[model samples]
Every structure is written in C-alpha cells, then in structure tokens.
Target: MFEVNRVTARSSSLDAAHWQRRLDVLAENHGVAGAVLGILHGDDMMSAAFGVTNMRTGAPVQTDTVFQIGSITKVYSATAALRLVADGVLDLDKPISTWLPTLRLADDAAHRVTLRHLLTHTSGIAGDVFTDTGRGDDCLERYVDGLASVPQLLPPGTGFSYCNSGFSLVGRVIEQVTGKVWDRAMHDLLFAPLGLDTTMTLPEEALLHSAAMGHEHQADGTLQPAARWGLPRSNGPAGGIVCTARDVLAFSRFHLNDGRVPDGNTLLPRALVRDMRSTQIELPFYDGDNNALGLAWFRQTWDGQSLIGHDGYTVGQNAFLRLLPSHQLAVVLLANGGPAPDLYRALYSEIFAELAGVAMPSPLHPPQGSSGFDTGHHVGTYLGYNHEHEVLDDDGVPSLRWAATGSLVDVMPTTEGEYEAIAAGGDLLLYREPGQRRWRPATFVQLPDGRSGLYIGLRAYIRAS
Candidate 1:
C-alpha cells in the first residue's frame, strides 16, 4: 500500500535517498527488469535507477543508461516542427501539400493535411504502417513516398486517431525544409544545444553507453531478451529515441523552461511552446482521465489539477512522462518490461499524491457480482491497420478477442491480445492479465464514421457491424 505523509508532502520535501530504496523494492516486487525514475520539482531534481539492463548480460542499469523512450519521440518531433513555425518557415495550419507538392495518399481528402493535424494525431492515416525503406539518408523520403500507395483511415483533420505515420510525415517535412536528416537535425537543434549527452537516436550510438536491451515474456512464462531492438529507421521520428532517465527529466526541464536552453537562448518561441500544451482536441471518451490531446502533449486531469505529458511503448520497453506544468513538477519512469504499467500506477500514485496532492482515478476493478451490461454496442468485428478486435456476446456476457493481421503476425507478441473481458459500470470492458489483479479498461467509443470502435492498447479499431 502507498502511504503519503501529508506534512512532508505539503512542505515539498522530497528525500531522494529514501525514494530510491522504495523504488528498489517496488521494481523487484512488480517484476520489472530494469527501471529508472526521474522527478523535477521547480529547479530541484532527483533520480533513481534499479535492476539490470539485460537479464542475459546482467549489466546493472545506471543513472545514465539509455533506454528506448518510444513514441515520446513524437513530442521531440513536434517541438522541432514548432521551431520551424517560430521562425516563420513553417505554418501549422497550411496544407502540407504546399511544401511537399508531390505528396499523395489513397484518400483524396488527405492531401489537405496540415502540420497541426499531424501533431494532434488527427491525420487519420493508417498508423502501424511500419515499412523498412533502408538505412540511408533517403529512408524518410522513401517512407513518405511509400505512403502514396498506403490508404488513409479517415479524412485528414477530421477526428481522433493515434497516427504514427503522421509523425513520420512530420519528420519528412523537417528533413525537407532543413536540408538535413531528422537525426542530424536533432543533434544540431535539440541535443547539443540542450547538452543532452545521454540521448541518442540509433543502436550504434546507444552502443557507446550502458544501453538497456529490451526483453519479452516467453511462452514458457519467462522473461527473455528479444531479438528485435526497435522498428525500422523510418519509424525513428515517431517512436525511436533512446535516452537516460536524467536526460528525460532534463528534456522535461527544457519544456518547463518554455523552450529555452541552459545558455538562456530561446530555441523555440514561448507562444508556440504554450500552444503545444494547450488542448487542441478533446477525445470522445475518457472525460476525467485524458481530458484532451494537445499538439503533442496529452492534457489530462488528476483530482482536477491540470497535467500534461506523454507515454510510450515499443517492443519490450515502456516509458511514462507526466508533468504538472502548473506546479512546475514532472515524473518520468522508463522500464524494460514485466508489469511496468502496474508498477507506474502504484509508484506515480504515491509521488503525485504527495507532491501535487492530485488523486489519480482508481484502476478499473471487477465488481463482486455480475455486471450485466448490454453487450449490444460491443458485439461486432472491429478492424484497423493490420489488426482485428471482435467483441462477442458470450452467453449474455461481453468478451473481447483481438489479433494482429498481415505482417504484424510475425512481429507482435506471443498472444493475440486475448482477454476475458467483463462488462463494467463505467461503460468499460475490464480485463486482467493472468496472475495480475490490476484490471485494464477496454473502452468503446464512436468513431467519426459513426461506427462503434474499440480502443485496446491505445489503438482504435472500427467495428464492421
């Protein structure tokens, strides 16, 4: 149980050493392979790392050991684009076709996509389109060209859909205007200027430091280092940056500083930085949890205190970054695997409650008796980018079965996202992994096309019924 001392919390006295020990025990109990916790409160900061980078190598995770930050890279990509806006080189509302005149998509309406659409995840592009163009300077260029034949899920700038491809498009746009690759631009613009020595965008660069390897749960119920490190290089702008906990906190500090570097040079305009955190679109569901999505940041509510940040997931690594800009506070947790989501829930619960006095909503739990919710809306086959989710009315009870389609069959985890979904009171279908009591919510929302959609693992699947 997480116990908060109100007096110490109210005083804002964060004992770093004490919390380090707590993290040590919590990481072990939750089966996390390796984890790092970084906190930023005003100008003061504290960080802790626990466990090994890789089970096979037995290398202890250090404070500076780099782990994949995943889609948190989107925020970085968005920041880079906003810099273009600050300089009057790029306009957020202008159609991207104005710059990339030859840009094409299967949907006719997609040609009108703007930078704002990409940043806000409303491009309606089929996101999991992970294609390997090659390890060359032309990779991003070729990746964007590949989208010519790729179909768009919905009309551009129409509705909410988590579009990874849209961010890759943003990377392409940055590459086009800057006359440099996305990785090189990152070094010249963000990393070197910000003094982020522990941050890198590729595996060869990660080899220079005590890098963390990703691990996966095997069929034999054991954790093993996976063969895959990350997705294609083309996907880098969307979810491929790797860095240390301290570096993440440092980056967070940069955001808190309103795009100013240590030398006090304004790398990004203060107005653009504020706009990025401002709510651009409200989600259809998740009223109190995730209130809305900003340009790249997630705008949320915790006990009515405004919170903004992003979370990321790759093959085996999970990362969370939450910031209370109002309080000038932030928390970042990067984990290698094994009950990471659960660990963060418990860990952040205590931290935020203590420091910010924000009450996180309780996790979904199965009721004592049957919750006979009408499974009518949920009964259908929901389909989206190489995935299918079928909600079945199993003898008057709702159950969700999901599977990866096409190339994902060879790439996804062992299971097909199987779950014994139980209908709940809050319009959510609850499911818990084997041997885990933490119930997860599978939300049902209406898609812009007026079809019922199921959101599982952050991706939305549209119902065919």
Candidate 2:
C-alpha cells in the first residue's frame, strides 16, 4: 500500500537505511522467519540481515550467515564451463559425448544434446524429483546416467523446461573433462579468483555454528522448523551451494560490472560474460513475460530495462538474485522457508515499482505484445491426466479456461502473444511464439515411437494465415 511518484525519475542514489526499514516491514508482513537484503551500486555496496537464524535458540541472523542457495549453483557451473571455453579447454557446441561417453538418452536424439543445451535447460531431459539415491562420490553421475532410461519430455532446444538433470550432466562433464570434482573445479575456476570466500559448494562442519535453519508456515500461520538433508557433494553443480548475502552480491558484481571484479580483476572475459547474459532460449510458457535463458541465468526486462538473474528453491529455503545492469543495481534476498515463488515475484515487483516511481498493481503484468491466434479456434474439451484446458470468451477475444483439481479459471490476453491466466489468487501470463503453426497448442515431446510428439505441453489449434 505504499506509493511513489510516477513522473519523477529515480535517483541513482538510494537511502540504505530507508530500504532496510522497508525490507524489514515487508518481512514482517509476509511472516518470513529470517531474511537478508543486499544491494550493490558502483563501488558502494550495502547489505542487511534481519530476523532469527534459529527460532529455538533466538540466534540473530548475521550478515554473513550461510543459507542454501539451491539452483543458483547453476550460475557457478555455467561460469566454470564458460571459463573452460574461454581457455580453449572446452567447446560449447561439441557433443557432450566427447567428455561423458556413457551418456545416452531414451531416444537417439540424446546424442545430439550438447553443452549448450544443458546450460540453457533445452536438453529435452525431464526434471527429476529429488531423491537420495546414491552416496557422495557418484550421486550426480548415477543420476545423470539414469537419464538415458528416462523418457525425454521434448526435443532438444525445442522449448524450455527447467531441467536440473541437465545441469547435473553439466557437472559430470566438468568432472570428466577437468579430471577434478565439480566443486573443486568451480572453486579453482570461479570462486577463488573472485574472492568469494564465503561461497562454498559443501557446508563446512563449522556451518552448524552459524547457518540459518529453514522454516515452513503451519496451518494456523505459525512458523515451524523445516528439515532438509544435505545433498550429495557430487550434485554440487545443480544445487549444493551455500553462501551469505554479501558473498552473493560480490559474485553478482562481476556480472554487473561486465566480468570484472570490484577490485579490477578480470575473472571472466567481457565478451563471454555478455554472452552469458544474452538470451539463448525464449521461455514463453513460463509467463507472458519475454524470458530468455542465458548460460545459467534467466534474463528478463522490468520497467523498460534489462535484468539478468535467477531464483532458487529447495526443500526448505528460497533465494532470489536480480541485477539491474543499466542502474548498476543488484538485489539479493535469501529466506529460510519453503519455496514461495509468489513471494519472490511480489517482492521483485514491489521493489522495482518503488525504484521506478510507479504504482504497483495487484499482480504485475508481463510486457505487452501482439495477441496471438484467436483463443476460440483452439478452445475445446481437451484433457490430460489431472490437468485440463478449455477455451473461453473474454471481451470478444479467445481466452483459456482451465480446470485443475475441480477449480476453474479463465485466462485473458493482455497483448498479442501474451495471455494472463488467473488461478488461486494469482495470475500467470502465457506467451506465444510469434508465428503461425500447423499445431495449435501442440505439446512437444520425444516419444519412444520413431516419431516425436509435438503435443506434450502445448494445445493444438488451427488458425487462418
């Protein structure tokens, strides 16, 4: 319920204390157990940590308190691969089979998967449900080898499906090619050079002394401890990282400064860093927003400017890292709680709106584009196991009617190629590729049959050219 003037430009200068107070207010409002906020601008960086790291002990959350970073580890893996590429030790386009010969997929298309596909989450591999399948040394490799037996959900590079297995494969590739473990390779290549001392792939035994305990919300809205087990060290590339808010900001500063450390060390080449921030695949299904997957980061625009970053979620924790390149501003939020995608979105929107002097809406809408095909043409009684899609009318335009678990909702188009679907007190935008296709809402999948399936996650509809 806060407002900022829309007409005035935001000053490059921000009041750190004021921002910290606002963040504290927001944390309380959201019933967050512990939170950390960090911002970096030019040579000046400010960070604040609040709430309790351990509710039982009433331990205060310190600025350096370590928290599980989840998938932000992908950024570390991607950077390591890019470093190898920069050093001529690896090829981004080479068949991953060159490094990991045992790699196979359910379909022959598996041979076509490359390092690029894995980095961009376009490897056609279905994501894995977390399981404690193996011991420390071979956990990631075993999981990756199992990928050959798992059915591919889509053709490589055809669409975006966030696949952690792909990243785990990348980790294996790193180990295979480098003759070192994934964590050690990452440390030698990226973390050590960047002086991110607090960023680590495995929690030290000493971590128990200072790490934050994750929390979950109970039915009565009370917070309770959420237990989480340590992931196998071999799976470090996917989500084994633990770090403090300040360390995250320092790592992000390299990207914000175009690959140079704050002290002027060129850890990553500027050209390669730019490529990492560039969009490799367009994720239209995630929301109407134009999201492009970089090497590991997801790049998007907010309020007319580009931001490069990613968010992470594991069993009992959530984290967000966003960098506004033009403003030389970056924000990192870490919370010890079950993953809350809505909270991340809301906070990001609220902060951006405040910075841009705009009125924050109930749910932020993705940028507008041309409306794609008329929804009516595709509207039908189509069904999937436990999921259904229906086309409905909205102000003379076609919209999606969805029914899941006996709950129904309508999706209306805000712009061409973009539609917003309302569900469970939240809205999500659907972005369409800009073109006419023979298959309307076609789901793309790689089936065991000789032929691939293009109707997996899509709805089929015929449209007039």
Candidate 3:
C-alpha cells in the first residue's frame, strides 16, 4: 500500500540506481513493506534502499536503517569464541563444560560437547526454543543454566541440526572467559574493531537509529506490522542483532579480508577466518540453501563457484548474507516481510550471474506426473524446540500438522496449521503453501544419531521416541 523513496550509493560494477528500481518493483510485487541491499564487490561497496521503514508510519527506508539481522548473530558469537581461541583463553576442541561447569542438559552426552560442536551446530542440543531470562547481566548465564530442560536432538559431534541454544551457550562461555556479557563483548571485539557503528544488540540501542520493524502478511492479502520487535534478550546472542545492510556487508568484508581491521590490526587470525569458511560438516540438501557449514558460516555452490555466508529470520523480518570468497564479492539483503526467500532467489540469482559470473541454482519443485509416495517411514510425531510435528494420513496422502508449544505460539502461523504433502521420492516431500500454487520442499531425513527426523522451515525435528 506504500510505495516511496529509494536511496543508493554507486559503485563501478554494481548499478545501485538500476538495482534500486528493481528492488522497488520486486518489493511491491512481493508485498514487502521494504528492503535494503548492500554489496561489497572487490572492496567497491554500494547499497540501495527501497520502500518504507514501517508500513504503519509511511517512513521511507534508508541505507542505514537498522533491521533485525536474526540468526546471523550466531556467526558473531562464533567469531567471539574464535577470538578467545586465538588468545588461548578457550580451546575449540575442548569440552565447553570445562569453562561453564554449571552447564546442564537433559542429554547424557551433553558434558562432552566441545566449542567446535557448538560452532558447527553438531552439539545435538535441542535449540529451537528460547527463554526470556530477566533483563540483567546474568541473562545468558541463567539461560544456559536452564538448558537442562532441553533434550538432545542427536549426539555431540555427530551430525548437523541447526541449533540456536548452542550459540547462546557459546555466548555464556564468552561471558565466563571475558567476565563480560555477550553484547558488550561483541561490541568491543567485532563491532568496534570492524567499524560497524550501527550494529547493536539491545532494543534500547536500536531505538537510537531508524529501526525497521517487520510486517506480516495476512491471510486476507494485507500487510501488518509485527506485534513484537524481536526475540527475548536471552536469545539475543543467537538471533537478535540489529543493523543496517551496510553493517552486514562490512562484517562480510572483514571475514573476506581475512579478519583485517581498518587500522591494520587483525581482529581474528587469518587461519581462523579461513576455517570459518572451511567445511566442518555437510548439511542435508535444503534446496537452494548451503549444504555445508563451518563455524556458523554456510558454504554453498553456484555453478561450482563456492560461497560462504549465512541467512537469518525472526518474527517478520528476514536477512541474507552471501560471500563469494573466491570472487571477492559479498551481498546482503534485509527485508521486513513477504516470501523473502523467493525474493532472494529472484534478485541474487541475477546479481551473482552479472557480478560474479556464477549462476544461482534453480529452486526445487514438485515433479510432474508424481505418483503416490510411501508414508510409512515418515509417519509419527517429531519433537521440535517450540512445537511438535504430526505426520498424518490425509485421505491416503501424508500431511504435516504443526502445533506450537512452549513460547512459540506468538510467532506461529496459527495455533495449528496443516499441509497435505506428496513425497517426490525417498524423503523429499512437496506441498503447496496456503494460497500459493508453488510447491515447497520438506524432507524426512536421518539424523547422525540414526534417528528419523523432519527437516522443515530450516529447523530440525527429531522423531519423538
């Protein structure tokens, strides 16, 4: 309903003006309130902003307007741990319990979880759920201490299951080492040294800037600003940083530059930065997603051109960062709402093709002439951090019923939602989202611990035993 100003900074290879036009058109077409894009092409940085900061206020978005960067904060936490590793204050391969002796989880093998396991999401900690500890300096400590209620998804050092609690625990470890909370440590170590003036963690800090709140799409085809700003402060270490696209791009540049600070000091060792992009483990194919992860960085290929980056989402906002390390090119996209993953595909596919000569792979869709799929292996209840997934029989076809539990009810599509799906083949299920013709992919995959798991919406749900 609101279409307005677009601002841009130019570069040699990136046509900010042209891309601003494209962003404006695409944003409106996709019904997003606004989007900001920043690019770092071989040190030639450029940024463009399109649409409004808030649909309710009608204020236009600017290149510097801060939006929640979501789980990308995980990378920042990993960097913090690596910095400690660089200083001999922490050991990457050593058990985290060495640092946080009070650490507890429901799983028996939790005591063996190393910093490396947490960094790579192999800690097997059930992490989707987050708690709101009091807004105090000890919030992370309380959160980590309460992790005893969380069950294990797999086994430590086993396989990949995207874990938010793992990163938050990493924040707790950072606190123990530096005697500073996660936010202060990140600001001192990464933000200050990297010159990310707009990057911040707390809502109070974001209030000083032109912060963009998210807008949710309604079932009646309307956009409404999200009811909440972000997740609780306790979860801040995992998914709660707020920053401009430029800051996101700048952070990417630091890693791409091998951790060099602007004033010649190295914020992180070059080997550690490279290790951040190296393959720690391979993730199951998530269709158009990076299938490999390294210390919170996701590695994926486009036309055999490897890229290292991460994407994140919260409430109603989505943020994406992709760095073509070999090409000295990185891009960041921050959007308030809508089918943002689709927008990422549409815009980034072209950007990489033009700027990096890499072709983005097409997203997967349901194959035509598809036949009935066996639902035997995938039926049953799978437990997640925030909800339980029920694989049901919808008139002979497999269907998923989502039921939000614990603290996720506020963010779920509804208290309960169901999607009828047809398996494309072994484990790949295709289902059309409500009111959309496009079929989306979900999978019933095996966990490293050999348990059947459901992979959907970038979160893992292990079969409830």
| lDDT comparing candidate 3 with the true structure | 0.82
lDDT of 3 by residue, 286-351 (tens): 755677888899888889888888888988899999999888998999999777777787789888
- Candidate 3 regions with alpha-carbon error over 4 angstroms: 1-6, 435-440
Candidate 3 residue 7 C-alpha distance from true site, Å: 3.1
Off by over 4 Å in 1: 1-13, 367-372, 425-427
Consecutive 10-residue window with the lowest summed lDDT within model 1: 1-10
For candidate 2, give the lDDT of residue 225: 71
Candidate 2's C-alpha lDDT?
A: 0.64
Ranking by lDDT: 3, 1, 2
lDDT accuracy of residue 309 in candidate 2: 83
What are the per-model C-alpha RMSD values against the true structure? 3.9, 9.1, 1.9
* Rank by TM-score (best first): 3, 1, 2
TM-score of each: 0.93, 0.75, 0.95
**Tens-digit lDDT string for candidate 2 (209-230):** 4787777555565667755444
